[model samples]
Target: MGTMTPAQRRALYESARFARETTYNGPLGPEYTPAGTRLRLWAPTAEQAAVNLYRKGHDSPCIGTLPLQRGPQGVWSIWLPGDQHGHYYTFTVTVDGVARETGDPYARAGGLNGLRSMIVDLARTAPAGWERDVRPVIPPARRSVWEVSVRDFSQDAASGVRPAWRGKFLAFTQTGTTLHGDGIHPTCLNYLKRLGVGYVQLMPIFDFGSVDEAKPLLRQYNWGYDPTNYNFPEGSYSTDPARGEVRVRECKEMIAALHAAGIGVIMDVVYNHMYRYENVLNNTVPDYFFRQNEDGSLSNGSGCGNEFASERPMARKYMIDSLLYWAQEYHIDGFRFDLMGLYDVDTMNAARAALDALPGGRDILMYGEPWQGGGSQLHRYEANKANLAMLNERIGIFCDDTRDAIKGGCFNAREPGYVEGKPGSFWDVGGAVAAWCRSDRLPPHAPSQIVSYVSAHDNFTLWDKLLCVRYERPEFTASDPVALAQNRLAAGICLTSFGLPFLQAGEEFARTKKGVGNSYHSSPALNRLDWARAGQYHALVDYYRGLLALRAAFPRLGTTDRHAPEALQFFSLEQPLVGWALPAAPGDGAWWRALCVFYNPTDTSRVVPLPAGQWKLLSNGTSSSLWRGESRTYERKALLMPYSATVFGAV
Candidate 1:
């Protein structure tokens, strides 16, 4: 996904090596501290900038009174050590002799208002980047990962509480959700603990303008996409927004809470660009950061107004440093890079290396959207050991295949004979499932990785997709308002599929965003999960819970190894129902069981061939029931009632 033209590829070695090497010269300085605080802010256009520390009890201290030193290039730095906790600090700079502006240069945490900078208790902070205690431990022989977002987790904040005996570092995982006061709600942590997801992937929490900042039509607040600051979590979501110190402290507290809940934290970072285009950083450091066109225009590589010149060593260093700071300071479990392709391949690898050198390298999860501007294909991303393709062995990606399969468009499943279903219909659902089912079949050059999900923050909810698919083809729509049984079937497909399954905050009860596929501009109603849906569709909710339990119980079902699609044999008759059979391994008599999965997209009885024998029903869509194994001849096939999916095994 690294940016490049075909010409650049031909002479890639030269052009790629030094395409954009400018350093990021914005907000560069040491951490403010108590010997007094020598403060520095990036003010290229300032005649002079001074640090003014305002303490609660002491007299107002100005830069001149301290050891403040104004360096060349307008970087004003000085050692002011008398500062301490409860001290409020800001930089006042005089520009053009008359213009004066005051702001926080290095806010550990706060919103875009940037009225003040918070003091830090570095002693309590987590290591910034990798966890050096562990080396590169090869991934488990099998991995069963479930993705959960924090915001949409149950309202009970304590739901993520883990056993007291298990410490945070030992049991960290990832979950995601809408930003709430003081990070993801406790309910998210509790739900993740109960659900046993390995990680929590949080959406953007940086300072962004209100929807009102843009046009009215785009005025909505379901997502956290509008970003103003790259370094801090938005103060609005913190417990105490009025006090920057409190907000910063609360953020660390939130991370600690999640760790205690036994869930790793993966921040959804928007490093591709920033908000307030005319902010001091971009305007003051001009050519030192952003990419420029040959004609002197801005390069819109990130689909944003401008893309950071990550190719630049300083830009890369800044990003890497920030990442390390978060990993070490906050004990963040992983990072989900936003618009990852905007960064250079080498730079990405370097960041990964830096993380690997950190304290918890073995547990760090690094993954992202391997695309840029919608034009780049996921496969087109850099293939280096650090890229998503290679990282899949270590990290992973938001697998589009799972989305496409349930929609029916995975691999050869689209072509004739490749898949059996209502002919000529877009197998979009099937395609989405294919990512999970057919992933092992991907080219060897591709990483053996998959991030399976029916829906995510960027697209329509799975329910919305089902409705659209039904609308596009009336045959798929339901005659009764029962929310379409096919929708339930699709859910089963995802929970049962291979690889990591990412559940959006609200997909459990078929939450809908009113078909506004990209609900980034929608309000809380569209994004906030209506927990009531659990009562509305108790059947489906229980279904997913059972599925998770089943995955946890059966190691063979969730193997992360490379397995060819042929390992699974698909069978169907008259094509209304499709069945997959996973044969057991040799020598393992208990493992020799065959799971015949049947999916009926129709509203009638489906008689599926089951190698006639008294077979036990491992699980039925309706409830929890275990049927004893019975002997039978391969004569009569099992019968599946309309609009359902059943998994059976030889008794």
Candidate 2:
């Protein structure tokens, strides 16, 4: 599309007053060229705007200041005649006769601690072989996501990462790294490969405000929820943040390394709110980017002080453009939008449509948290999950029902779920498991629309939750064999469920956050993944590995059709012992034609009668022994151990 004239642009913006389209807002950032750099700022409420060019390593006393000419629809533009690639610049906009200096909201790079926006030649920032980088195509039904934080992945002493590379993006690129195993435990990329997760949903990597990029080793750590620059990579994760290109290159290299290891990368994006109210967008156009209440106060739907008005035309455009930019520029395989429900459904649909239009875009995964932190001005039906019927089939929402059902309530730590042996909890938990596992209950258009998991980055880890429950109830003990069995059962249900399976980092090995529920600002000692824990719970890790392998081997477990009739049949809904049967389809491998899975949370062994066939015991709590001779007659009962799960199959 050609550039629109000033008058045409104004007319376009005016015509689409509240419409959710980005075409009207032309590019609103520094556009670089060999001869010069063209700068544009969208400050509709501003009466004047100017671009101040600064020398390297200097914040004040700019080398030169250029006045920006006013364009239609409150746009200001200025062009330098010579190349300005290495210089830093900031815009000074006079809104309501008050001048305020701010960085470019669309800047691809930022100076120390994001104090200023830097003009960069994006072509030179790409790592070697970046042009050939391609993400692996993973179907939604078969997707296994492993969520991770860049720093926490390798920051612990037992992480086995190199000294210089520890806690940096380069840490993921290390080859043949192993942690806490006697020549058996895989570390880093090899660990991921062995874990069998198809995608790595990385925590926020954008230029966030919490970490001081200028001094990355100053003992400051954040989960990166507070975004400063949407398009730029966070400098704290790079070995050198002084040069903007280094952060960009290191991030791409990390993505390339992950792709090389047969794992796709999913970026966790936070577009609902920024780090501060004094952000660049707010400074340039006061109160324009955020949602306002009837009293002229900013909305706190994000629970982070202010929320972005994504329903607005320009805001919607910015989000869509940022998503496409990352998909193309960084070769991102997918996106995990943080607090996505705060955004309007139309904007999300537009983003999916735009992404689908790109090459190999159909394979890109799109999913997010379906609920927001607080009430939004948009109707409840406009939320992502509430409006799933209107959303495209490719988009998925996290299944909190399954999560809470297996592990207990997220808000209250004392309340126990079915796995915890809570009285009268089996019926609800069984229904939730069937709904998510069979793809028939709580139905979406497709099975890919639901993402099932027991735990994630938000609340307590599975192990920690069990420990907390033990503290609350005298009957439950942390190290009890029954608790361990319950933990295994939770993992079994999550991995064996029908929809996409998601696991938080270190979940396989029983990761813990020391009983701290919200670790967003916790120390590295609390947030870092302790590989030693993996060693302690090696059996549990192996069980998780086996479950993933079994799910991969049996396509019947991961059906993509949501409308397909109940693939699972529960024997009795009222009993504490839950049993289901899954019949395999025709033309299958040596795998059985019919599979029976049973869960017994009671303390005593339960003898449950099977269907009319000789059933082979594939997995029984501890190990997966696929021996054909290890069979039990249908008429003769099968034994289920207390607080354990068993899988039986017959061809």
> Tens digits of per-residue lDDT for model 1 on 506-611?
5666777676667665554455555445445556665666666554444445454555334667664565456776655443333226666677766667676676
Residue range with the least summed lDDT across 10 consecutive positions in model 1 = 164-173
Q: What are the per-residue Cα lDDT tens digits for candidate 2 across 1-651?
A: 343343443344345552333235578788999899898887776777898888752445788878999877677889887978878988898865678988998888877777788898888887888888888866543578999999888887666788778788998998877774346666777678777788999999998998877665537778999988898898889887877768888999999999988889999999999999999888986666677765556779899998887877778888898999899989999999888889888888889999999999988889899888897765434546657777787788898888888889888887788788887766665665554534344545566677889889998888778777767543321355666787888887777666778999988887878677889888878888888777677888888877777776666655656653266777863377788887775554527777788887777888888887777787786774443245543544788877777887775
Best by lDDT: 2
Clashes per candidate, residues 3 or more apart or on different chains: 84, 0
What does each candidate score in C-alpha RMSD?
A: 8.4, 4.5
Clashes of 1: 84
How far residue 450's Cα lies from its native spot in candidate 2, in Å, is 1.4
As a TM-score, model 2 comes out at: 0.91
